[model samples]
Target: MTNPLFYAKILLFGEYGIIEDSQGLTLPYSFYKGALKFSSLDSEFEKKSNTHLTKYADYLLDLELPKGFELDVQKFQYEISEGLFFDSNIPQGYGVGSSGALVAAIFERYSITKYNPENISKDQLKNLKKVFGLMESYFHGRSSGIDPLICYMNLPILIENKESVDKVAIPESEEGKGAIFLIDSGMTGETGPMVQIFFEKMKTEGFRKTLKEEFIRYNNACIEAFLKKDMNPFFRNLKKLSNWAYEHFRPMIPESIFNVWKKGLDSNAYYLKLCGSGGGGYILGFTKDYEKAEKMLDGFHKEVIYRF
Candidate 1:
């Protein structure tokens, strides 16, 4: 059977903050995606993927499956034996939900009581998040499940803190000067350690206060502003959030991009923030003028994600 494509995701806001109940916004990036397929035993890639799928299936079976979710383990094992594999182009460890996409694809095809994307309910969404979260914990030590949820739905997810998650609509693209882009840090980041650093930092009262008063406030406001198409306030709050991240989330930002990150803020031409857990991988960038931002970041690799 042919399976549907699962796309990558960008957590535009709320990298570590979402762990502390801060709001987050995630969008599907169709540029890179994955799907499930069965291939002949001749392909080495297919053999390796089949092996990994077997291990992953074993892990999922060990979990306390959520209600309304069922996996046909026998069939899955048979398929893997037949060289079932995930054929994907999404880069792993780049904070773009690569593993999440894989998990979503597996569940979409294997889960018997599947949640209908067209008519998903609050209960179904919550249950699906729980299932995906548990399934993904095998990769990241812990997950909010927002990544796979976005991949599964292929829709923008607005996280209004830990309790409330809803599929949100973003404003239509504008042929304007402002834009959102991704800057490659040229290194893969491990989410576990990056998250560990944030957790350790949270033990400090000052860090906790800064996160609550500054980070969460600006992060949430940025989402609201962008949704309303309030460009001025969006960039204004984004700048503040970017500055706060530079000052507080320094460890999470890779050493190589520190200068470039600061340069953007100093120039007032653009702003940069952690794309996911930071450390290394893709750093998110915002610019009021893409042409100018490109000139400023000429040497580095940058991909425009959304145009304002």
Candidate 2:
């Protein structure tokens, strides 16, 4: 049987800053998605996927599974062993939330009991995120689990702060030249090292202060404006957020795209930010005029995520 698919997620705001309790806004990308499905007792990719899933199920079973967050580890392991495979089109390490989708799908389909997002309290969401974080840590050494929760719920998730979260709805895309897009970095990035570097930088008071006061402020504004359907304010805040990341989180941006990333900001043709961990993967871009950004970023292939 095929489980429901979870769309890939993009952390529109709160990339690294979110780790410091910065406000975050994340939504699902329907263009790319993944789901757990049973395969015939064959196919290398299927077999490999099943084996990997089994290992994960075992890990979860070993963990002191937290309260409120529930999943049928035994049955999930059995089903996965009985030919289950995660069949997905979402690209891994492209910062599009590959592991997130899998975690979402698994939690959704096999959870012995489910927590309803509607009647559920905010604390429940946080707890779920914590549990999912522990479960997803199998894939990435560390995880916020926000991506998986958003993907799993297929809703716009807003992180009010470290302790509060809920499903939200952002303004729908408009018919216009303004757009949100992704640019391939042409290399894969691992979350572990990027997170390690982020933690290392967190040791500095200057960095932490800037992140809390400046970066998070702009990031939160961007989320609020976008949710309110105020494109003008959204772009205004996006520009500031992009600039903040460029200045403080330089290492996250790859060496190759460093100039282009900066040029976009300087020229005002577009503003680019880390789609995920940055170092390498997909770089997110925002521009009121897609033509201008396209002209500036000639060689790199780009996909429009949303239009405004």
Among these predicted structures, which one has the highest lDDT? 1
List the lowest-lDDT window of 10 residues for candidate 2.
114-123
**Any idea what lDDT model 1 has?**
0.89
TM-score of 1: 0.97
Report the poorest 10 consecutive residues by lDDT, candidate 1. 66-75
Q: How many clashes in each structure?
A: 1, 0
lDDT of 1 at 275: 90
Index of the highest-TM-score prediction: 1
Error of 2 at 84 (Å): 1.0
Off by over 4 Å in 2: 116-120
